[model samples]
Target: MPHPDLLFPPDREVRAIARELFALTRDLPLICPHGHVDPALIADDAPFGDPARLFVVPDHYVTRMLLSQGIPPAELGVPSVDGTTVQADGRKIWHLLAANWHLFRGTPSRLWLEQTFADVFGVETPLSPDTADDVYDLLSERLAEPAYRPRALFTRFGIETLATTESPLDDLSAHARLAAEGWGGPGGRVITTFRPDDVVDLEWAGWAERVERLGEVAGADTSTFTGYLTALRSRREAFIAAGATSSDHGHPTAATADLGPEGAAAVFERGLHGTATAADAESFRAHMILEFARMSIEDGLVMQLHPGSVRNHNRWLHATHGRDVGGDIPQATDYVRGLEPLLSRHGNDPRLRVVVYTLDETTFSREIAPLAGGYASVYIGAPWWFLDSPDGLRRFREAVTDTAGFYNTAGFVDDTRAFCSIPVRHAIARRVDAAHCARLVAEHRLDADEAAETVVDLAYRLPRRIFRLDRSAA
Candidate 1:
């Protein structure tokens, strides 16, 4: 069971205020603007296969930490890209996770998993080597129930709107099926997000093929630069038609460029031909960020820039398991200089909504808060990636609250790949926000009523308003 004061302040007066502030958000519905839950899982509404698949095999956070402790992914039933060999036994993986549970202490992974084990699965006995099989047996039995299906859990979790990301090359058959089933639109439960990284990032391994596939899907020519832009526009329209309200760009940096069409076209052709140098690719990506911004202004799709992640940093793991196996690392980001091109041109535009997320926390006070404070288009995204923890969330509030304020922020987003962690993650964020606000009230900085209202915004209103979800829903 969750303790009443899990993430609250320890002081008597402040803890009381924190508890009061949290009550306002306890029953509030979740508004997840960005996440990586597979659409097929909800579309199929099938029973989760087993305990290991639900909690261990698919979550990179869990696997990466275990891998860091010198545990092979093969031992945890993680199959390779080729699917050549895999550990097929579920009980064995569960045993390994349980025995190694001690490694998660004082970590966010433990916070999420333990809360999930207690609240989601109704297990509070604590997990360890001795009780691994007992817990696994309980999870397997509950997952077998129809109530434990993905859609059932979605409804039970009080998720008002959940957006899953897809690439330009994707057919979005899962999203199409979801819409056909009536789980879409501004007010609908599930939606898709336009992620064009695969098609736009020139140095990506299959960039040429992904662009060709984009042309095929959108019925536009790709051999020419004009044709390529047309193809990208068509795909954006397709994404919008399938209920996408935003476009996500995951770049190496927050760089933006405004190159003329001829200059861009020269680089584009060189890129597709595999003749573009590293500098050429970087410039092309910067220019495309500006192009995507223009597209966002033309269309209604909000733009999101998630930059500064050195993705797939582990060469061996990346080669063997492919991406999202948690080898990414965050480096320092120069948001001020990098975003100048886009901000100088379109930062004041009321129509353009650019929510910026950074893996680099050092930029929170220096570059990010100041930028959001200066520009009308930019809104600071919630603590993202590795920073989605208790202390990280608190630090974000402390860092940006002075400059950006609560309204200028995009509110909390559970930018997670794990399905089971969504509710617990949101719960943790709410507690952290409440406690942060409580400190303000305790210091006589704000009134209790005012703090309560702000937390409600942090919990529900700001996400919907900044993400433009409440332009339609409450």
Candidate 2:
């Protein structure tokens, strides 16, 4: 269970001040401008099924840690794409988690799950092999309650706004279903974000087929570069019509380009015919990042770039289970050089809103902060992915606060597929930000009144303003 003063500074004076700051934002409705929770979870409004499927199967944080301890994926209920039968017993998976609960010590996953078990389900007993069955039965009983249904939990969670990401190839039937039921609009809670990674990456499996379907869905030709851009623009409009205020991109690097018309067309044609070399694929992806920036200026979707991830690094798992079951590693990012083309063109445009997230911590002070500090258009993304831990958030503030300051940053994004972890993650950010502010106050650098406002802005408002979620429906 989380103590009342959890994560507070040990210094008595600063700890008191930190409590003051956290209180200002503790109950503010969450603004989840970017995340991976499936909208169908709420649109369907179904039971969460069981504790294993809810906490262990879909949560990579738990699975990744257990995998590091030499546990097979089959024991954790991970379904394989290669038709391998995996464990289907919920009680057994929960027992495995209990048997290895000690592995989570000092990880953000431990903090999240402990608080989730306490606050969400009112389970305060320490999880252990001896107590596993009792805890499992208690969780099973609570999950069977109507109060624990996904939609009921959303309302109970006080999520004022939530955004789920989808590729351009997605018809967004779930979002459409929610919108028709009065769930997404000017004051609605659930919305979609337009993610074009599937159609943009020329080397992705089934890329050509997805591009053809993109044209079909948008009612435009995709044979030529111009037609392809038109189809992309059409999809952006569809996303906007469905209440998307932002577009997301995940590339291997922060590279951007100005390939001009002919170069892009040649690459597009080569890609269509499956003759594009690796260089052709890389350069075309770089060009699309910049193209999307230009499109953001025209069409009003905030552009979010997540770069420097060599996704699916665990080859055997991906070969059998498909992508997103962990194994994305960060590499060094060259933001200064990679983004020059886009920044040189649109960095001064106030109409352009670009939030860049890096898996590389070195880029925080060296590249990203300076870029956000200089450009009116660019904003620093919050600590994300593997770096969203308590120390990681503190490190982010320590590194970037001097260069970019608070307002130039786009605050916290849960960026999670684990829906129940949203409030806990935000609580972690709040506690860390309060601690950061309390440190400044202890050193007499910032006033307490100002820290109060800063905590609220970081906790709730900055994402709303940056993602244009506060704007009325377009």
Candidate 3:
């Protein structure tokens, strides 16, 4: 039997109203402005290998929860960093995930998985230990169909554009291929986002080598600080040519430092020698952030900063498994003090687009909203990472709406690795936003028509505008 709460918007009258509002915008093409999905997947346009990789391993939301329950990641088919096989049998992993599905009972992962199963694969039976084989077989069968290929699924999902993050060392060959083939010329678009985490942080492993490679790619000397910055600039241009419209930064904090050129050069010199103190490294990073903002003003690329994750908190897990396997945790972060330098420099600039995201909910009302509300260039990103659930999304809207209003925020970005869950995530976001809007209408704060329009804006229009996709060549 289907779950009683399966039908969203729970109240009949509210559900009817929400459904009516959803109908107006539910089919609007998706604008995935920011995500971590591999650009190569879209470039290759290959069929996914199996259900385990599709549903279990790539989804940190699913795997990390399972890991918390003492489930070994290897048993769930998570590949090792060295590319060794972990689990070859998909059925066993599916059964394990099914048996322990209760771990996600109250979580958004449960909601998304259920929606994916029902809406995408046409599965009506609930997933459980007994039904694991049945569900896996059904998904596998669907995967075999031509309609389920990456590009085909992108079209079916109504994704007008999807921006995938890429490291600085990357050649953007996949994005180049997509553009060369004109895949994004007419019906679909896949663009790259310049992610320079590996190159920016002097603390990162292989930073020196990655810096050299960045210089090599850009035909710069890279032995000096000026050469390094120039190489990054050139790479940004290259990414732009391949359809990129944004740059993403995953900093540990929202700190930004606007040091003068001499001060910045001193810090960069320390970084180059691998002898920089922690303070010097941080200052260099901050100075580079200011530089990135200046570059944004010049290049017309949006700047997205996702800060506050204490990445790889679990050293044992990181050693055994590596980063981004659900071991990262959030810490309280300060944005006001951290961002003061950058804001003082470029806050009034209309051409520079800086979207700030946080795992620290405390900042929404007190800091983020107020800053974004006032600044021409600043905007708050949607609920992200650990907070992308229903309750989290609701709190975000409630906390910021009074201060920032709707327009100061960028709409939803799925920020997911699980390709099949894209539509599922977007559907949940839309429904939640509509339900919130419905409450506003019920209270007479907003007319029904305005609420309806806001639903469409939140779902489709805001993301396009904030990500600057409408200006993109289609």
Candidate 4:
């Protein structure tokens, strides 16, 4: 019941085995193949600003909880788009979280925050209204230290490689800086992933302007459909040259289209002219997923598809606060039919590697597991977003393991924007997996040695191999 071993299983016999398994993987190097940590932090090696800006302001997991309890976002210093000023006090913001610590009693955010405070900042006392000031002072002092700089912590966290998402318009100057310094071979390295949703989705805000910018950045004409495809290919090549190994798509649905060139051109024209019907927009988005797959097949970059989130569900918040402010909500997704067009063309190919994630948990047993099990190119993505908690992860293993098995799954991905929570999230997953493996040993489903190997694979090796980091650009 101590803070050190909070997540370990309770059974006497199983706890011992789980503890042993945890010991094996607790010190292994971290493999973070997917995340949203800003590369500028690492490139500039700047010290984190303050407790609230570093933790509360940027993390939706923290802000959404406070908002649900009737607290206005401005109280927590959430920025506004119309040039209005919010609260400017950092210590006061920390007090709000400390006072409401009970709200996170059984939540994963509590676990991650506690571990971060204790391990990362040496703040061992429980956070509360009484202890808030002292904890704030301690964290503030620590954030000013040289060792707490982003690059230093990247090395201290024992991360072998960390991937950050970028758009096609990004020149990857930060990544380019790291590459030129030869920082990726042995010491910690940061890489970029191609996230083309802004340019690919016709309904997205500023899509026409973004497409025009993409064309300019790629040095290709945006006037024709053929020219657009060529520009997309050029952008992918730029990502590859800047040390990217994957492309990420966060489409609203998993639909894929295989329209002929003429049909595709018509859709492209509608998108360019800003006269696209909703159906035409959907058709264009769907067709681009197939084009992305084809490009992946040729370029050797892994393709990641995560669909089924009805983004910006809180229209009031979106209009006031812009996107990714914890307003996104998940909807049910259909994979068997939605991905048929893409899979039919590239599913059997050994050269292509596609990892798919879903917010709809029901599809795990019924659709995604079976699809990954049968296809050579498809691999199941780990639990993400709303499903990244302890119970959700256990349920994912139970549902998918029978059909897809261990090898067919792309290992764990943190998928976080909270930089300090990276190690905490990975640690929680490793403990959960070790507990699962311990249960298998207790039930005689697996021998101890084999279970140890499985835990290592789930935690480290599979991520490296699945993301192709073993031979990734140095």
TM-scores, each model vs. reference: 0.98, 0.98, 0.95, 0.97
Q: Candidate 2 or 3, higher lDDT? A: 2
Report clash pairs, candidate 1. none
Per-residue lDDT tens digits for candidate 1, residues 1-474, read 899999999999999999999999988999999988888888888888889888899888899999999997878888888886878799999999988999999999989999998888787868999999888888888888888888988999999999999998888898878888898754568888999999888888989888888889989999899999999999999888877888999999888997789999999999888998988888999999999999998987889899998989997888888888877888888999999999999999988999999888889989999999999999999999899999999999999989888888988999887887899999999999999999999999999899999999899998887776766642
Q: Total clashing residue pairs per candidate?
A: 0, 0, 0, 0
* Candidate 3 residue spans exceeding 4 A from truth: 1-13, 82-85, 185-188, 472-474
In candidate 2, what are the lDDT values of residues 312-331, reduced to their tens digit?
Answer: 99888788777898867788
Model 2 Cα shift for residue 179 (angstroms): 0.9
Over 1-474, each residue of candidate 3 has an lDDT whose tens digit, in order, gives 224223346777677677777677678888898988888888898998888778887778888888888987888988777776788788888888999998999898988888887877777778888888888999899989988899888888988888888887887777778878886422238888889888998877778888888888899988887898899899998878777888999888889997788888777777777788878767877888999999999998899999899888988778778888877999998899999999998999888889999999989999999999989999999999889998899899999999899988899999988778898788778777887887777677989989988999889888888888877521
Candidate 2 has what TM-score? 0.98
Q: What are the per-model C-alpha RMSD values against the true structure?
A: 1.2, 1.3, 2.2, 1.8
Backbone clashes in candidate 1 total 0
List of clashing residue pairs for candidate 2: none
Query: What lDDT does the true structure give each of the candidates?
Result: 0.89, 0.91, 0.84, 0.88
How big is the positional error of residue 199 in model 4, measured in Å on the Cα after superposition?
0.2
Deviation (Å) of 280 in candidate 2: 1.3
Model 1 TM-score, all chains together: 0.98
Off by over 4 Å in 2: 472-474
